[model samples]
Target: MSEQQKGPAGGGPGGQRPGGPAPGNFGFGPGRGGPGAMGMPVQKAKDFKGTLRRLTGYLRPYRFSLLIVILTAVLSTVFSIVGPKIMGKATTKLFEGLMGKIKGTPGAKIDFHYIWEILAVLGILYIISALFSYIQQYVMAGVAQKTVYGLRKDVNEKLARLPLKFFDSRTHGEILSRAVNDVDNISGTLQQSLTQIITSVVTLIGVVVMMLTISPLMTLISIVTLPLSFVAIKMIAKRSQLYFKGQQKALGELNGHVEEMYTGHNIVKAFGHERKSVDKFNSVNEELYQSGWRAQFVSGMIMPIMGFIGNIGYVLVSVAGGILVLHKTITIGDVQAFISYSRQFTMPITQTAQIANILQSTVASAERIFELLDEKEEVPEAATPIAVVQKESEAVPGKAIKARGDVSFNHVQFRYKEDTSLIEDMDIHVHSGQTIAIVGPTGAGKTTLINLLMRFYEINNGSITIDGVGITQLKRGDLRNLFGMVLQDTWLFNGTIRDNIAYGRTGATEEEVVAAARAAYADHFIRTLPEGYDTVLNEEASNISQGQKQLLTIARAILANPTILILDEATSSVDTRTEIHIQRAMNELMQGRTSFVIAHRLSTIRDADLILVMNHGTVIEQGTHEELLAAGGFYADLYESQFSSRKRQVDAV
Candidate 1:
């Protein structure tokens, strides 16, 4: 039977036997920040100006629209600012009329006609102000959406071009938070905050000017609290900045925990480790809650504190304006105007203070988005690419050169980290149409060879060539097109079975897909499904059995029809009967091709052209299975232990 079909020592797929690793330690360890870790670390942008400048580059295309928005915002704020002064004129006229009537004066009657005229002007100004506000909001919305759309597109493209190492070193949830959460934060700031800044500044200047026109003494009194307001905001905002950073980091860690737990929920339940998973999640969740509330509480304090300072300024202005009126140095209308201006002036100050706190959080989010956009991409393609021409009949119309699958790795050296070598001084040669099997213990450099051959990771030293031409001379896309790979982990998207199979070759015919499935022994089960080839798989393809999924992947590789094939533990996760069928299918697929097979089951590769036994990052033995057995080296020992153990089991059965 395939090793995956049986748990260790003939147990079920749940691995419920006594000696299996605990579920909590399935794929995590102390080094991975196990359950007790605090939170995910955040990457803060060191160069804020550089990041902002690059972000604005995306906004360059909408400069004319932004200019219109600015003009409309100024117009609206100016109209709104002047309305109070006009209303103050009407108040003064009414007050004079009242005083004249009380004294029984003939020409002191209230100017009702003039009062109506002032009211009409005030209404007109308000209507114009509202109209401009609407126009500015409408225009700015389009600008913000377009700018963020461009940013999102750039980020998505950058993800496709990043190196494999970048993904290997980070979790999926961490990357997703940057893509989704951080980007949305930037969008909100752009849509709302930018125009608010323009309006607040303009209103503040206009209110101060109007206040001065009535009485400079009252205006001076109103602004005495300005310095105090600034001091409070500065102190509070510095502390708020730290909390905002913590909140963002905690959110990322929480997301990572959720993603990992849900993905492995089945194993957690099977092994009765639900409590452990929940406890780990609670630790991360508690951290997030603490940071989130602290950030909100600090930011929330700004508005009320600014309002208190503004109220103090209002009381002082009111008392001073009344004394000036009593002295007959200013009209009642002027005092009323001064008080109205005082309130208007302070409103904008409160708004600006609130915006400052929001701006800090926005900068934190933008820094994250910029960090992702600035990640290192894959190595550049060669200036001149060498094309692969596999068969004489398949030659291009004008290209004279041809490529065959004769691979050679000469003295290749590689290490994941600088201090630890994974492979060193490795040399191998495979003639065209040869099947080379790789055998090794766990942690040996089995898959590392495939990574180098595919150029997923460049070797530290030495050269790997195909058809006597170095792979580095060819474009990555052109080189990858020459081989098809099927790993142990099957990846099937949420789509119809037919679509998944056709993913191998673009625009493949229905007949070709069916033929490939039939050869891989997957056609029988596909037909038995309710929708046959039209069956739509769920997310993660959980609707199908593991063995069935492996068959479908094999069918896909067959349809690709590459000149070289790579199968890494391909048949390890199936039943014994299914493994036999898969072996027969693989033999057919590997015909007339240079194939590399990495397998743990020694019996499966007994007929291979060559077997390479690897240990400690170097090949210790190399020969045919029978020749290695006769020599009694490392390969012989591995083969004897596995087969002898299996023989005893069969005899007992």
Candidate 2:
């Protein structure tokens, strides 16, 4: 990594802080404090269509259902208008029938029948509207679920293809939030928003049409208030979008903190920094709280305010209609229908306010999810990649394993994301079954060599070849499987002991798992555990000791039994007795495989076939232990310091 990256963003395994949006993170920005009350204003909110258009691609497969849902909502709204109109007709005819019946006038005998027919029509309209609503909701929910399923699947597949550098650059919390929380928010919104938005729109249009049919003059009077509502809605939408974006970003930050604390709880407790940790958590939690309140407060005002404005329109319609009646300019039925039409305007306006709040949240979540999927992935392959080996047998276990353990670095010079090389003009070769120890003072490119060999980072110059092929020519996944690595840091998944051991060769039998455990000297401790081989190691193997965790990792590699192994100071963290046992296990595992050991303990690598003493980027000394001791170079001095220290400790004992 670059020097800039080395300190912040993400540290490393144990120190990896995970990911959250930064404090000023309303939108993805170069700098951090986004707004407080305002949602994180997207960098380019006006250009959100591109993201929206892309998100709509997930729903493309459900286009037919989408159409059906929309049409049903519109049809339901249109049919709903028929209900109120029918009721008005029944009321008008019943009143006229009373006057005619009192005088025994003509058409009075049939007026009662007409009223019943009108009432029946209203009942039919109500039933049809309810049925359409049911179909629309059911179909919309199904479409939403299917769309979310497709979206989740695509995001997962894309994430899997991203290079290790991507993870190196971002925190685990950010990625986790995108996978679970962000995707979940989107799914919930889609389930109902698609129908609700359509229903609200169709109902508004239907109401406007019915109001015009009753009287255009009264409709105009009611709709003048429409302009004021529109302005209010747009203003609120802009403000709410900012806060909702802040809420989501805050939640992402909070998630990152929780992930870090949970993973490093032991470290915090051991360091006696409980108060410090709690204070940090509270600060993040408070930011989340503030963002949620601001977003909710802005969105919550829309519904009630729209209702108030719509009510004013309703009152105006009633007053105007009473005047028209006094002047004998319109019938009582016209006045009654106009009042009902005024109600139509008010109800839809209220619904619009409710739908707008939901729509803002949906947009915010969609924006965040799209941002992740669009992250630049490293190591993209050809549309039709060349396959060096394609045999089905190559994928199978024992038959698939190889012994071509030769690894050579020819004039290899590397730098981690910089021009100055960490390992310059370095040439090394490991023949099959050779035990090569790479020793150096601190900051002498020890880890960098292994990283280059593992292809975790690319060399700026020179070639690294394994088994007569340039490492770049090989598929990364296939190449890594050939080498078993045991690092000082043990990262075990939450699964059965057998599951963790057989993770590489997933189809390996239970017997293979136990055999590998026994070889690594891990079986004794594992058997003593509550469930033994069936035991689950939750979150970094919390239930086990550090020594046992390292042992289990060794057992995992032992089961794979690669032709080459990297024992990266695997025994560094254990006690003397445990280290000895681990060393013994390492010897057994490395017997027929090429191995590279990076160790701080000078005693451990003394018996290695070749010991290359490194200083800065160059190998200062190279030979057997006796050969180095005779030369009286850097290794001799390092050995003398440890050797004298051990003598003093033994004397004290």
TM-score of each: 0.82, 0.81
* Model 2 lDDT tens row, 270-308: 999889888988987798789778877786676667778
Stretch of 10 with least lDDT, candidate 2:
1-10
Query: Can you write out model 1's per-residue Cα lDDT over 1-653, one digit (the tens) per residue?
Result: 01211111122222111221111111232111121111222334567677778778888999999999999999999999999889999999999999999998988899999999999999999999999999999999999999889988888888777776776676655676566656765777688878989999999999998888888888888888889888887777677657756765666566666766787899989999999889988987788788767766776677688778888887887788788989998888887877778877767776665455455545666777788888988777777766644444354666734556899999999998999988888899989999999999986788778778877778899999988888898877667767787778777778999988887777899999999999889999999999999999997789999888888878888888877888888788889898888888888889998999998999989999989999987888888999999999899999999999999999999
Q: Candidate 1: worst 10 consecutive residues by lDDT?
A: 1-10
For all candidates in order, the CA lDDT equals 0.78, 0.73
| Residue pairs clashing, model 2 | 24-33, 24-34, 26-40, 39-242, 39-243, 40-242
Cα error, residue 651 of model 1, in Å, equals 6.0
